[model samples]
Target: MKARITVMRTVGAAVMAGALAWGVVTGAQTDTPPQDASVEAVADAAPGYAVEDYNYPQADKILAEKNIVLKRGDGHIVLADCASETGLLEVWARSRDKICFKVTGNSGWLTLEIPSVYGVKGSADQTAQVDMTVGSEEKSFDVAKNSFAAVGESADEQGRDYMLVEIRTAK
Candidate 1:
């Protein structure tokens, strides 16, 4: 019985290996079957395969802790600690103690939801526009480069709570 079990395990491994080999061959097939030298070229990673490389880093951890579902960005705008720096984009919130974003590059964009955001600071070279929503009403604000500006509820005399939805930057 032990010998039979060993044979079955070896057969299972061989079957798995063959299946993997077949999948690789079909996935890498171009107009022609991949030959020895052309195999490497034909097996270039698929476009769909490369997309996952750009996923938000540490996304699961961030989402679990912050309740922030940061989906995707251009890699130019990213979350920053409260005391990060002045020359980058800064977000001041009423409820949140520490909320900021570090924006690099001449042009960048990000989409997120931070409730009760009241103000923002923009970098000198990077003019920024932010989209916010208060209830069903949506508002946009233009923050001059290198300056601080009131946004969301801070701009309202009623002191309504507004959620910052998106951020765009351009040179």
Candidate 2:
């Protein structure tokens, strides 16, 4: 009877230890939280705004400082200080003696404004056409390569004030 009792007590202890180990493993596994199936959008995933690279640089500053309403231009034509370089397309005005543009490449076009220009001097090897405006009238003139040409008020019969508006050049 004594031996049988000891055997039964040993069996009971084994069963209790097995139950405790199983409980510990299950409790450890349940510590991880569950994930939901619902989806949601986030604000940072949207696209960002950007500026166009082709737009002219410092255009607003140029307008404010020069009093020039330079709208746009092909990269081939650009502003220059007079006599700084050769083969410039020069705008001679009644107010300012000259405004210069460095003309390069074989062909180019620019839209700009010099309030009272009356003459244009062409690049060394390229012919240019200039557009001018006076009141309600618009006119165009062709300038020869490497030479001066009358435009704006100089080309007018009544010699009215005129604004230089455009220039297109070709080799």
Q: Give model 2's clash tally.
A: 0
Cα lDDT tens digits for candidate 2, 19-102: 999999877677445586454579647888995454456778888887667667777777788869887888899866688888
Query: Model 2, poorest ten-residue lDDT window?
Result: 31-40
**lDDT tens readout by residue for model 1, 61-141:** 888997665656788888877576667678888756656678788788777788898888887578899999999999999
Output the number of the TM-score-best candidate: 2
TM-score of each predicted structure versus truth: 0.65, 0.66
Candidate 1 lowest-lDDT run of ten? 46-55
TM-score of 1: 0.65
Give me the runs in candidate 2 sitting further than 4 Å from their true place. Answer: 1-55
